[model samples]
Target: MNRDKVVLAYSGGLDTSVILKWLEIEHNLDVIAVCIDVGQEENFISVKNKALATGASKVYIIDVKEEFVSDYIFPTLKAGAVYEDKYLLGTSFARPLISKKLVEIAEKEGAVAIAHGATGKGNDQVRFEATIKALNPYLKIIAPWRQWNLKSREDCIDYAKKHNIPIPVTKEKIYSRDQNLWHISHEGGNLEDPWNEHDKDIYMMTVNPEDAPDKPTYIEIKFEKGIPVSIDGIKYSPANMIYKLNEIGGSNGIGIIDIVENRLVGMKSRGVYETPGGTILYEAHKTLEKLVLDRAVLSFKKMVSEKYAQLVYDGLWFTHLKNSLDKFVDNTQEVVSGTVKMKLYKGSCKSVATKSPNSLYNEAFVTFGEDDVYNQKDAEGFINLFTLPLTINAIMKKEKNEKEKQII
Candidate 1:
């Protein structure tokens, strides 16, 4: 009898490798392994061969770097969506794109089910399942970590050895990681302890701040309607721009965030993330907005940005609210075209200068020097009207106290 086929999101890593073998040996399902390349530094050829060797009927390696950057990264960047105000949201947005691809591949291959290695305790499981259900509710979703007998990473390693499957992680150096063009995240192992200092050796995209160069690096970023277009007057494709910024920003120890963040699964998890390029872009984008956006719009957009970050982090990417937020964010970006010059020094990136053709700043209005644009005395009338309600309330309180004194 022919077995039903399931499309698995295979990373050729420890968890997925073990799942690939388990799916064949236990469930008796023909697996189609799908690996997505979103600018991670990995050998795709080796990944494909390993998946096939582990009993996959076929393997696919899709290069979605540009699409991931343009569609997911840029949109999040424009919304200024930073989870908990520190995480640049590198992994949060990547899951939806991956889930979309999994659905596409499953349909193409006529697979009735899709599987992933996301654990029950983490947010990625929610992200993947939510996106998959939103896209195709009919397909069966398989989450091995939620159902499997294996209790720990050590068990996974032992299983891989028992099945003769090669994996990169071991009991000694068992840091679970997810890498893409935008950033790399490190979790588990030493990171499980909140007080444990993050090891400098775990950082891949950035150097330790202590080890960073003594000199600062200066660079200018150009934006086209809130989307990063160039670095230092050199225009590049979306992926290349991030790639270049990562290199430049990494050298100066720009983006390394270690936080115990509240997970969507009702638990707090500790993670150390390296997001050099993303940090720089976020700083530049916000600085440019200061030059172009009005005070009221910028202030209100900050609130929207927080909401957008929460929505993205909570795996509500395909919802109607997310779509409406995107429209609002897009409208704000209309005047966000500009260039921002920044200085990166020892783990800190600060914007030094910003200029935009559509800038709302009026030099004459803000100048300390005497100018025809304003008269300082005009403020007296404005302040009286503005303070009228407060003054009346204070007078009424005083009169009420006097009445009480008279009765006494």
Candidate 2:
């Protein structure tokens, strides 16, 4: 049994609570529980109490919500890093930030090792370990699930009961969930079965489409470099804006996705995500990009975003490659200043209009009828030059055919 003080990433959930106590008994280590609150809608007082009661020597509840939004979420939004063209990557963005906190707390508390409760089978195990290694290569990582004989949620519950550790998870509500200001994701239980459909009860943040209001809700989003700054002409801080949008978007049933995604760990998992604020924010940012970004730059950025999403989702943030991608994404956002008006009806969000001072869309030149700004006659020479290779190949074929006939 290792007797070094270990810092555990605690969320006040069943897995974390159990891990806290188990670390004490199994490793004979003094556990320092650190909770990074990224606006996940939880009671801190309760979580702190639960941690102390479960054998945590101390508890550190850090409020990183505003930083999570402005520093992490905004950068990814500007980069347009959506994984698989469907996921907004709410969970992906939060992982690194949480892991960064772990590194800092470990150094301050004089702990030699960092502990986490991530299961061996999930992407989070990779995320936590990768970030810890990247930040401080010397620090030891204690992944209990990988080292322990505990196999399932049932085993964990039984262990928790045996030790008198209060756990939130039960056999009935067995869904594994992660929530933040950006989104909430649900997996496990029925979601483990690919054929099982997500019932209405699985979702928390958004209303069901059938249960949504009859009237459509209209709102406008303002942006500077793809970061949302305002809603309906009212300016707000990054955290406040996102919080407001989540409430408004949730009421309209604006964000819900059921997908079977390929995990980085070489397995496929099916889950449902509720990302109300993030959904509207993504739509607004994309609409503004169309108005301002040039054709070639826009297409190339799409390619970059694909790579960026994979890097972030697979847990490679603290590298030089990700840093270079950040520079490219930052350069494009110089002219991404704009506002997008949208209509939210049922579970759908549609852009009514988009405008930007740096817009590349020239109405006069693109008009079909009688545009003096564009010369239609110029197309004759352009098409001839563009088709030169094809024209030459055809001429060569004809001359070769005539020579073959003469020889015959």
Candidate 3:
């Protein structure tokens, strides 16, 4: 007799590896492991072997790095969606794409259910399940952490050891980490305490700011309608662009933030995130927008940016409102084409110069030097018209005050 099949989002990490064995033993289901790669530095061959060795019926390692950059990362970047003004939403947006892949694989494998290793308390559980339900409502969702008897990472380690599972983490040194092309986030362990500072040694992709090079690194990034196109006059593919920037930005000790953030699960969690390339890109894009976009559009886009960030952070990527906001963001990006020169030094990435064909900054119109434009005389009329309502309110207040004094 054959057992029912269940598709698992396998990361080859401790949680998913143990969950794979648990699903086989407890649920009596044949687990088909699916690992979606979004440009994480991982050995795919090793991940595949580990999944098969851990009792998976079959393993599917799908490379979605290009799609992750183009479809997910770029759109968020274009919208200037930074969660809490710090987080780059690296893990946030990745969950929906991963869930989408899980659904697709579950359907193809004819699996009865889809399983994930996200814990019950985390936002990922919501993100993964929400996308799955939105995309394919009929598929059964199994959350092992919610169902299992294991209470913590310590218990998970014990289970993995008992099952002879090859795990990446040990009790001595365990930090829950999520890495991709956009960023790497570190949580768990000492990070649980808001007072504890993140270890400098925990950094994987960047150097400590104090250890960074003495000289600043300068680079020019060119954008086409808000999408980053080239660096230093050399064009690159979407994924390659991020990869290159990450290398340059990482070496310069750029983009590191440790924050106690409000999770969607109604709790505060402390995490340290490294988003070197994303930081550079966001700064450059914002600089370009300042040059190209008018005051009104830029002001409104700031509100949209906050909303877009919230939507992505909460895993509402597939909703109708997000689609509509994307349309608005895209419209705003039409004139956001430009080149930005960035200075990177000691963990700081700043835009030093920006130039754009669609720039709204008219040097002649606002220059202090004498010019034929004759803007000085026109300012009196403009100021009077702009302050009309204020003037009327002041006059009425004076008249009322005078009447009150006479009556008194």
Candidate 4:
């Protein structure tokens, strides 16, 4: 009898590699390893060979870097969605896209279930499962980390060893990492201790701040409708833009953050994230927005941004609220076209200057020098009207105090 096939989100890492074998051995299912490439540094040929060698009946290596950048990263960037004011939601948003691919592949292959390597304690479990459920509620979702007897990474390593499965991690250097076009996140091991300082050796895709060059680097980015279009006056595709910025920003030791964040599963987890390009893009974009957007619109958009971040972080990407917020974000982006010059030095990325065609800044009206527009006399009337409520309240309070003193 032919066994039922199950699609596995294979990353060629220890967790997913072991999960692939476990699903086949324990559940008697034919595992189809599906690797969705989002511009992470990986050898797809090696990943494919490893999956096949580890007893996967078949393997699919799909490149989705362009789609990831245009569809997911740009949308989040446009919304200015940052989780907890620190995390760029690199791992958060990728999970939904990965899960979407898993659902697609599972349906195409007529698979009965979709399996993943997300741990029971992390937010990824919720992110992956929520997207899966939203897309196709009929497919069964299998998460081995929650079901398997393996209590920890060590146990999983031992299981891999017994099964003769080649793994990526060792006990001495065990850090759970997720990488994509936007950023890379490191968790587990030393990071679990919030007090422990992350070692400089853990750095990838970036140099340490202390090791960065002494001189500062300057670059200009141009954006059209909130999406980055060029760097240094040269236009680039969405994926290429990120790659270029990462190279430039990484050398300057920019975009490294360490934080202890609350997980969706109701626990605190410490992780270090490196988002060189994304950090630069966010700074430049916000600088442009400040130049173009009105005071009230910018203030209200700040609230919407926080809510959008929560929605994405909580795995509500497919909901109606996020869709509505996306529309609002797009409407705001209409005037967000501009160029921003940035300076990068020693892990710092700052916007030095910005200009926009739709800028609200009026030098003629606010200039300190003598000008035709006479606004000096109008200020007295404006201030009186603005402070009317305060003035009235103070007068009433003084009169009431005088009456009380007389009676006493």
Better of 2 and 4 by lDDT: 4
Model 1 error, position 193 (Å): 1.2
The digit string of per-residue lDDT tens for model 1 on 1-408 reads 989999999999999999999999999999999999988899999999999999999999999999999999999999999999899888889999999999999999899999999999999999999999999999999999999999999999999999899989879999989999999999999899998998899999999988889999999999998999999999999999999999999999999999999999999999999999999999999999988988899999999999999999988899999999999999999989989999999999999999999999999999999999899899999999999999999999999999999999
lDDT of 4 by residue, 73-170 (tens): 99999999999999899988888899999999999999999999988888888898899999999999999999989999999899999999999899
Candidate 2 off by > 4 Å: 1-3, 399-408
User: For model 1, what is the error of residue 393's alpha carbon versus the real structure, in angstroms, after optimal superposition?
Assistant: 1.0
For model 3 the TM-score comes to 0.99
True-structure lDDT of candidate 3: 0.94
Lowest-scoring 10 consecutive residues by lDDT in candidate 2?
Answer: 194-203
Candidate 2 positional error at 236, Å: 1.0
CA lDDT, every prediction? 0.94, 0.91, 0.94, 0.94
Query: How far does residue 156 in candidate 1 sit from its true spot (Å)?
Result: 0.6
- Position 130, candidate 3: lDDT: 92
Which residue pairs show collisions in model 4? none
